[model samples]
Target: MPSPLVVLSHLRWDFVYQRPQHVLSRLAATRPVFVVEEPVHADGSPRLEAIDAALGVTVLRPHTPVGEPGFSDAQLDVVAPLVRRWAVETEALGACDAWVYTPLATPLLDAVEPRAVVYDCMDELSAFDHAPAGLLDRERDLLGRADLVFTGGPSLYRAKKDRHSSVHCFPSSVDAAHFGQARPGAPALDEPADQRDLAHPRLGFFGVIDERLDRDVVAALAAAHPEWQVVMVGPVVKIDPAELPQAPNLHWLGGKTYDELPAYLAGWDVCLLPFARNRSTEFISPTKTLEYFAAERPVVSTPITDVADPYGDIVRLADTPAAFVGACEAALDAGDADRQRRTEAMRAVLARTSWDATAAAMGRLLDAASRAPSAHPPTPTHSSTPARATSTL
Candidate 1:
């Protein structure tokens, strides 16, 4: 039997069904998958809250007394023991593989005796707004201990390739059949309630509303065309809500579940990837870009290096607000033949990769590591998880 897979992530399982959820869920079909999320502040004694998140994946959330956020040391101090206890309780210690998403989760490496450590660097978290201190330090520590490293995009791979001997670039992949529900002739899905009443020529974006979002571009686009109803979906985090641009035609509908996204997509005329040109967005290859294509929607995006380099021609890329508005206008006014050409191009792009294939490739590497055992050795300083001292408490 395959060894159980233990995932340590900064993203919540219930938040948005993204890369980690998609890839891990597929991998879960062959073996047990346990996702350990960042600690949530709570008043009670520290405990691991286990929730079965379908696809045979169990989400383990650590509830700790520490209130500090962003995988800080204070939270780690509380999280380590809870994870150690859970690892022992589940009999996963020394018998499982550790898949890490956040660098700060490196300390918890001491909690489990992982046969192989996979660091799936999904984002450059340290470059994000309000990122916690000591993240780079943690990343350095993690790279030293990781047996294999996977990056979410080409840009990220370039950034980390020199740092690690074994680095792989597994860019985001789309679940076509699911998002295809939004296609014109596919079985009609009911329009989401909030978006149902909105007028046509709707331009929408669905993803995390954070520092990466170009609010200036969004506001300008809405202002330039009052007849166009601009819809924004997803959670607002790290930034102040009151600071968001408000206009009669602009709608910030807040976060929606993964299942609810297709319905929202079905009602949109064109999709958007309005990201700011900043360090926070330097390496982002927005997952929603392929999703929009799967839904057969025209997309307008900023010239983010990742998007511009690979998808420049397929997606309309502009930097200035005027240029962004012009691009969306072009999409909204696209003729039937143009739309057909774009859809055909999108279908071809979707054919190149998928989550299932990505997971299978990862599993192959992991299985090889399991069989070889000594292919990659851990740093001498932290070779094995330290045994807990019963009298410490």
Candidate 2:
């Protein structure tokens, strides 16, 4: 009989902007999976019902209230105790055969006595803007405690390999069947009347508008090519819209739900990933890269390490603003036959890098950890210290 498996993550289900849901869905097929998430809002109501419906797994949200101001020492203090208690309670609920903790909840997992521990390092948290201080230290401590560490991309794996003996690269993968539906002639996003009135060939980008975006590059591209309308779709994070320099041709479409992404992808002549070269963006393995390919659209990206790897063939890589603009021009100039060939190549590549494959790799790591000797040694007992000579009234 197989041992029960449990997954711990700090990310809430409503914040399913990441690929945890897809990974959880794959893991659920083999064993009982439980996701321990943070509380969604200040009200204490969990936003995990949709995730429960989607993954068929138990979703546990602790009742602890997040601290005031959201991002202070006070908040961390409020949340940490609750998270620790939840971890302890979850451990007591059953004898978990193995445990996989995503990066955010790694500290909590450290206190639990699971049979095996696997650490999933999906992102370099410390490099992110507004990340908690001492994040890297915490991650290092978690890495030391983990039986195995799994990274989301080659770049991340390379960065982390020196810290852990057992580290593997598992890049972001797409739901091929879902994304493949975006072939030309499929239903596209309804272009806004204003957008429709202005343009013919539209270059688009769809994802979170965060610090990782090279705003200067985007502005330059839009300004340089008045004929091409550059449409951006995603909610802004860490930056105010007013602060960003905008071009007349640039349109911000806000964000769309995951299910509606294919429609937006289908309508674009090309997809762009203009990431600023920084610690956070350097190791990122954007899930949208393959999604764009699956939609049969040409792609242009900044020279991020991971994107420049296996995707160099299908994705045109650029270093500077001028180079990126030139790449976009090249992509636009390419005939439909060239575009289709590249898309086919991308499809073939993505089929091999599926969520099922990622889950299988994780399963293997967990299995090995379950069999391997414990990395953590037992604590030694200490004799009581002699009482000091103290005067008490």
Candidate 3:
């Protein structure tokens, strides 16, 4: 029987359809995938709740007291025993591979001695607001213990490569068919009521509206171009609502289901990636970049190194609010010929990247690691080139 895989992650499996969901859903085809989430505080006895998301994909949430939701000592105490029992019972015939997205679950290393442990470093967690107290130290520990480490983008790989010898860069990829549905005649089904009345030449953004968002820049952009409508979608976290820049031209469309996104994309004149240049956003690869390209929409964004460096040819990048407004205007005034040329350029790039391709490459890496003999973990040399990965597609 194929070995089961348990993934401990900071991201909720049901939240947004990003890297974790895209990669693991495909992995489920070959092995049982149990996505273990952080504890959710509840009133009852500490117990595990397993929800079946699909065939071979299960979302496991440990519910303890309300205050014990994080990887606090109490939460760990409640989760360790339950998971240990399940891991052993499920993998009696084979050793399960433990894939970790957070080092907060390090206590599990003692409780469940998995055959292999992989750290998928998708973000610089320590830089985020309200980050756990010991995140960096725990990351260091995880680095030493992890058999393999994978970064979410090239910038992240560059930053973390010196810390671990096995780190590899797997930047964000797109689901072409899914996002490509945003064509001229595509139905924008399930359009949120508020978005229906929004004015056009809609300059829109969709994704978590967090601290990484450059609120001042957005406000300035709105101020400078009162005629152009600004639409902000997705949930707001780690920030207060009153703190957001208010303007008559700015519309907060709120969050929408993934299936409903294409409609919004189809209606948009241009897409926006307005992440602020901050510690939290320093290494972000912005999966939305590829998604927007797949949608065949012109995009304007801040100088996010990851997006600017690799995708600069297709994406318009600007540093200041004035520059951002100029880029938006340029995107708006793009002639048919200019638009067609850029569209073809984007398609050529998107053709090389897809969620299926990314997952297949990752599956190969995991299998290769599992089959290789265990050797003493090497110290980071910091200068090695990243390993190449490709898919048959």
Point to the candidate with the largest TM-score.
1
Candidate 1 lDDT over 118-141, as tens digits, reads: 898888888987777888998999
TM-score-based ranking, best first?
Answer: 1, 3, 2
What is the TM-score of each predicted model, taking all chains together? Answer: 0.93, 0.83, 0.92
Per-residue lDDT of model 3, residues 207-290, tens digit only: 999999999879987899888789888988789988999999998877777887887887788899988999999989898988
Estimate candidate 3's alpha-carbon lDDT, on a 0 to 1 scale.
Answer: 0.80
Tens digit of lDDT per residue, candidate 2, span 123-202? 78778887776666667767777777777777777787777777766677778777776777666566544445656478
**lDDT over C-alpha atoms for residue 196 of model 3:** 75
Model 1 superposed RMSD (Cα): 8.6
For model 3, what is the alpha-carbon lDDT of residue 297? 91
Error (Å) of candidate 3 at residue 361 is: 0.9
**What TM-score quantifies how close candidate 3 is to the native fold?**
0.92
Give per-candidate clash totals: 0, 0, 0
Flag regions of model 2 displaced more than 4 Å: 1-6, 39-53, 63-93, 97-104, 110-112, 185-198, 371-393
Worst 10 residues of 3 by lDDT: 382-391
- For candidate 2, what's the RMSD? 12.0
